[model samples]
Target: MQITQLPSDQRPREKLLQQGPQALSDAELLAIFFRTGIAGMNAIELAETTLSTHQSLQQLFNASLGDFCQVKGLGEAKYVQLQAVLELSKRFLQESCQRNTVFNSPEHVRHYLSLELKSRQQEVFMVLFLDNQNRLIHQDILFYGTINSASVYPREVVKAVLRHNAAAVIFAHNHPSGVAEPSEADKIITRKLISALALIDVPVLDHLIVADVSVISFAERGLI
Candidate 1:
């Protein structure tokens, strides 16, 4: 059926105008970009086909321009349009990561770092610098390797905290092995970091170890 022939409240574009973008289904939202239909299909039908070809919307977003163009009735122009929207979504996610990250407690820190570190295949040591109000000032990757006492330098931690003028800092690293439990080496490094930061009057707030879907907090466990 023609989209315009549908009830005004049920039409994707009309519903978007009346209720906002969130009111539209994934296929309905996609159909707005599709705009037109070829023989034997309506715009919504074509969109449904496209969505079905790639099992999920995420898979569709991850698909290359060539992949979209290969779809029947979808040409390079529509592929570019879809690619541009996906790129904008990616950029917005990155910007949101920079802006909206708040580390209030151990759980907050874990949630923030999980989004950034959960997918990493190798160990990545990162530091979160916070201001006097505990708002995040900046986050930096300090080291990327096997987590061990020999690899992390306490002096570098001190220097980075000073450079950022951070009142407090949270340390986090990922275990590629998917074990959130801190090893003896991780404990030793946490002690070293706490001691080094203490000398400069910059407090170590927490040390988190991120595994696949879980996190370990040093402060919560009395390890810090």
Candidate 2:
């Protein structure tokens, strides 16, 4: 049955207003975003079809423009809109992190970096500059290279912290091979960076190895 055929309270928009966005299922949430459907289908049906085709929402959002356009109600305009919304979510997370003074939540850090770097095809080294209170000051990608290799200069890392006037920092990099294990080079680089930064009294809070599904922390392993 069409969504209109359902009871007034059962409609997607009505349900959203009555409860909350969190109360809706994936299909219901997607239906709300779609707003309408093509001939012979309702928004709910289109959403269901889309979910079925993609299997995972991440895969769906990551789909290429040409690929995503093949969907029934999804077109160029909608694709661009989705991209903007996704970017908005990333910035929102970053803003939330910036508002906190003491950054002790490892999971939140992992999640934010996962969204930022986990899906990259090449390795990227990032630095999170923090103030004396450990609040986030800035996030910058300092280096990028092939999946297995990235050149990180301890002097450059030190220079960046000095440039930002940061008192502390968390180092992070993504493993394009999907392994979060810290290689021998990763461990060596971490120690060298620690020694170099210590000369100026800046602490290396953590070194996170971001993989496809997991984030490994050197601090958690007593390596920091």
On TM-score, the leading prediction is 2
Those runs of model 2 whose alpha carbons end farther than 4 Å from true positions after fitting are 8-10
Q: 68-148 in candidate 1: lDDT tens per residue?
A: 777899887887787777557545554544455444444455555776676566688999898876767888999878533
lDDT score of residue 100 within candidate 1: 55
* Weakest 10 consecutive residues of candidate 1 by summed lDDT: 97-106
TM-score of 2: 0.90
User: Taking the tens digit of each residue's C-alpha lDDT, what string does model 2 give over 1-224?
Assistant: 78989997779999999998888899999898888888899999999898888887876777889888888778998788888988987887788778876367666687789889866889999999999988889999999888797999998898899999999999999998888999999999999999999999999999999987789999999999
Give the top-scoring candidate (lDDT): 2
| Model 1: CA > 4 A from native | 1-108, 146-150
Residue 113 of candidate 2: its Cα lDDT? 91
TM-score of 1: 0.60
User: How do all models score by TM-score?
Assistant: 0.60, 0.90
